[model samples]
Target: MSGHRAYTPSLRDRLTKAVMTAAGYLPGPLLRPVAGAPRRVDGQVLDPHFQAGLRVISLMSEGEYQDLTLERARSVVERSAYTVSGRKIDLAVVTDIVLPLGGADPDRADLPARLYSPVDGDEALPVLVYFHGGGWVLGSIDSHDATCRYIADTGRLKVISVDYRMAPEFLFPTAAEDALAAFRYVRDHAAELGVDPQRIAVGGDSAGGNLAAVVCQQTRDAGEKTPDFQLLFVPATNMSARTRSYELFGDGYFLTRGNMDWYERTYIRSDDDRLDPRASPLLATDFSGLPPAHVATGGFDPLRDEGEAYARRMADAGVKVSLRRHPTLVHPFVNAVGATPLAKAALSEAVGAMRMALAY
Candidate 1:
């Protein structure tokens, strides 16, 4: 601890602090060297810097306290060889197709969506509206395309990944409503999109995953049969620091306590809204009658405990549930299918859960 690097928040941290102070109330890995590059699947060489970044994180976070920020979040991973190394990660990951939203509304939430469909489907098929994760700040349809494409091609389910309004600009329920609109639209044109009204689902990762959960609650409160299942990938369920997860694994993993503190402060503008169930599902009184759920968590992620607890809570309430944990992976590894070896296996398990829920 004596040789520890002095504590300093990253760029994302400074930005978060600036925003919070403006409001006046104040808020807020391992592996050994294996020579040139570790041999991995597909004959791809492991990025040495990634391992280096992990070392840096461990050196700094061993027993220290620091402000979390998206910048620091990126620094730990980006500093790795993945982004800094000379080699380009130009793998054609996946293809995206843009779809036009018909109607002369003149302001039809202009956007481009890449559709992924099941293997066989003649009539209406089950559709799953999705939102990508970036703490309600980062991430786009592009970042999550790989997972969507896999669902479309393998599960045979029509996966509609939505690009919603993010924060510091359009926080809180903005993304939630956009997700609901996409689902309602998908339901409205079930026949055209080849989607079955009764079989639609909603899901996403991290922040996106949180949105998916909110969408489910929104649909149900509106007196509608919610998505057949809610697939939350390492979702940030609670905004406040009341949960045991927040207290237990606050730091040390990829998703540090700092990263979360910064994210919640950024996403929630009105302090009153932080307690809203839509904003933080953990505060919701009722978990009954919600749709079935399949939640995945990375063992090393700070948010891991809450996700697993939510799954258990749903099961206790009689809602069907399955929670899977990837002990060796980080928060964003699920979609790094080609970049990380654990991705394929973990995603496959998730896809299986989806297929079972959709029963297609």
Candidate 2:
């Protein structure tokens, strides 16, 4: 990565960032009373700062994703990323490249990807093919740019953020196919991409995380090479059924049950699709021989239970796996890293694990 110009925040983005930063400094005693009684569930208490932040977020929200039209939902998510994503960290190299979609019709557009490296050089570095999470319908490379920059800079590795096609327009298997295609392209062309062929990893957040897990399982079943590691952040592992977390935290948290229902309805063609391993990796019967994995979940997130369950299942099948629950965190914590100290710490911890896993 070569030195690049820093990102300039819009006035509103700066204000939102300022408010979130200031909230982090407020005493828990002060926030708890203001945000209401401390919320404790599943033996984890919500962080007071996040409790206050969510209160403010709810006050400002016009509507949840379920209430908005497709175009409006997409626009809101894109804009929301800037408000919470923190300032983009400067990297040595950040460039955009097109990835050819494997097995797609000639007329279909190629995947758009952004490659991020912390240091500029010809060194063949370990690389992570990252997918942006938006419930399989809402995010983009640009939306996740700041997080990728943070991971590349902090983890001291290269990150290629894949802008896989989204739902309603593309649907479930399409995103999974694109994820597999992107990982294969990186592995096969590692030298050209300035990455080590033997050290490639696949990762993503939320829906993207689901895709990463699917890619690992898909490759293993097909007798193809799998990535060296998998990095999942607040991943939704099972779509077939809602877990206890959904009943506990789904409504009030940023990711609501209604919103999840909308995402699933839009991304999946039918109920049967939810049971497909590619759509719901947890439903897969075999987890043996999958690559080592790091699955991080928010204690308050609806997807937390499933993500942890997936990790445990993988471990039971003899795959080396680690699961870290950020007790006070919520879903989409990665986007808050720039403004939230705890969130930033959590991401750094996960990225640290990634670095160690891929270290030469």
lDDT of 1: 0.63
* lDDT digits (tens) for residues 183-253 of candidate 1: 67777777887678888888899888888888887887789767888888998887765555455555534
Determine which window of 10 residues in candidate 1 has minimal summed lDDT. Answer: 20-29
Top-lDDT candidate index: 2
- The per-residue C-alpha lDDT of model 1 at residue 261 equals 68
Work out the TM-score per prediction: 0.72, 0.93
Clashing pairs in 2: 1-92, 1-93, 1-119, 1-120, 2-92, 2-93
lDDT per residue as tens, model 2, 197-241: 888999999999999999999999989999999999999888889
Candidate 2 steric clashes? 6
